[model samples]
Target: KREGDKWILNGQKKWIGNATFADILIIWARNEADNEVKGFIVKKDNPGFAVEKMKDKMALRIVQNGIITLTNCEVEEADRLQNANSFKDTAKVLQMTRAGVAWQAVGCARGAYENALDYTRTRKQFGKPIASFQLIQNHLVEMLSNLTAMQTLCFRLSQLQDQGLLKDEHASLAKVFCSLRTRDVVSKAREVMGGNGILLEYNVARFVADAEAIYSYEGTKEINTLIVGRAITGFSAFV
Candidate 1:
């Protein structure tokens, strides 16, 4: 709602990371009058803004996620993001960040692979190092293949970004592929570690859990797939 030069925001947000301590927030809301999505910069101390931390998280527990409530949150016109007039403008930011999330998937998989490889080499069974076993080597190879493929693909993604040719579909496709591969790679990493894999002391456990978060954030596999599907087919499936 608009009151002269101010906007009154009322809403609730969930699964908001870092909101508990964030000094400022970039809020996206739809203009009731124009029905166009707009962005606002709200300070943490705003009278109508409140945040409550969420607990019992399964993944990405290190980061504080919060629930935000806005009750007649008053924001000045000067605080509105002049560049963000519509969802399309907001999408420009997501497209770039989605590419970065693809990179994050790669890193997560790499960490798990490296840790698994080290454990296999040191862990012994049947009077020999497990790394010497054929099955273990096969799992390692599969993980390596996925990791390499994801890395090379993202390398091209970065190049496209640098050339200013990055598109939403490109980022979505990369995010889908990399995040899926990361899940596989991390699972294999945990498998090779045996029972120790689930133990936080091994670190692969954390990677396994964190991969789940990565798989869903920045867009889910299904949503990103639709973005790519629409791009290739010239059909927008989004309703």
Candidate 2:
């Protein structure tokens, strides 16, 4: 709501990463008058902005996620994001972030693969290291294959983004594929770790849990799939 020279904002955003200590926050709200979503820059010192730190997340524990409440948050007209006039502008940011998430997934899977490989190489069984076993080698190869595929997809996605040809569907497809595949890669990493897989000392255990969080965030597998589906099929799967 607009009030003289300032806009009043009231709403809540939850599971927001970096909201707890962010110096500045970029918020998107629908202007009741125009019915178009607009962006606002809210400083952390604003009296109307309050945040509570979320606790005990299974993954992404390093990030401080918060729930933010804006109680009649007041913003100067000049604080509005000049380049972002509507929701479509907000979506452009998501497209880039989704691509970045795809790359993150690849990195996560690669770490799991490397850690699992090193563990197997020194983990002795039946008078030889487990890596000498045919089945263990097979698992290692499969993990590498999935990791390679994720890398290739994200590489092209980055190229498209650099070329300014990136589209929402392109980023969505990469996110959907890489996040889903990372889950598989991490699972295999744990599998090769034997009973030690679940142990925190092995490092693969964290990746296993982290994969679940990555699978859901930025967009879920089903939602990203629908984004690509709608683009190629010329229909809205969203109701």
Candidate 3:
């Protein structure tokens, strides 16, 4: 929205997954009068809005994403999300999604480890299966260690969530920790596969690329760390 209590939305949102087919989308916009963030439910048939499908994504290719444009989009005051008064309420949604992202990381890492392990069992080096080698075994063990730790931590995180004690800082911490460790595990999994590591047919390569998206999305490590830092230090580091 612009000035003078008039609504005039003109912007584009990229990588908006499912926007092309979504019946209703919650669009976040700044109020013209107060410049405050507000949300409106935009229906699929809205004339002023258009969504273009984003194509040729290397990672997370199965997830259909779209670039949305809102041109002179109009919504009544009653259509605005009343509860989303500020960025704080928006954070509540992110906190919940962050926890889910942590679980997704675990799944991604576990899939890579399993695939790499299966490959190692049949891949031979020095006249012996690669899985029998001390170096390969060490790598597998390290991957398992990190994966186990992430699983346990996320289990505890879900407990906090179930108990209604989950906070933004807590979710951010899990998101940061799991995503970072998942990156390490997936990279090692790819490394152990030798030249086949980079091949999408081997499967570990996809996990490696997907990990990059998971690490940056929801919240980057720096942002999540600052969230936890502010919780403990009582100082807002976010500018």
Segments of candidate 1 deviating more than 4 angstroms: none
Q: Judged by lDDT, which candidate is best?
A: 1
Better of 1 and 3 by TM-score: 1
Q: Which 10-residue window of candidate 1 scores lowest in summed lDDT? A: 217-226
Taking every candidate in turn, the Cα RMSD to the unseen true structure, in Å, is 0.9, 1.0, 1.9
- Model 3: what TM-score? 0.94
Q: Which candidate wins on TM-score? A: 1
Q: How far off is residue 139 in model 1, in Å?
A: 0.2
Question: Comparing candidate 1 with candidate 2, which one achieves the higher TM-score?
Answer: 1
Per-residue lDDT value at 91 in model 2 = 86
Q: 1-239 in candidate 3: lDDT tens per residue? A: 64344356668888887888999898887666676777777777776889999988878887889999998876656667879877778889899999999999999999999999999999998898999998899999999999999999999999999999999999999999999999999999998999999998999999998999889889899999999999999999989
Estimate the TM-score of every prediction: 0.98, 0.97, 0.94
Error of 1 at 36 (Å): 1.1
Q: Candidate 1 has which clashing residue pairs, if any?
A: none
For residues 1-239, could you state the per-residue lDDT of candidate 2 as single tens digits? Answer: 89998999999998899899999999999999988889999999887999999999988888899999999999999999888878899889889889989998998999999999999999999889999999999999999999999999999998998899999999999999999999999999999999999998999989988888888888888989999999999999998
Report, for every candidate in turn, its global Cα lDDT versus the true structure. 0.95, 0.93, 0.89
For model 3, give the 10-residue run with minimal summed lDDT.
Answer: 1-10
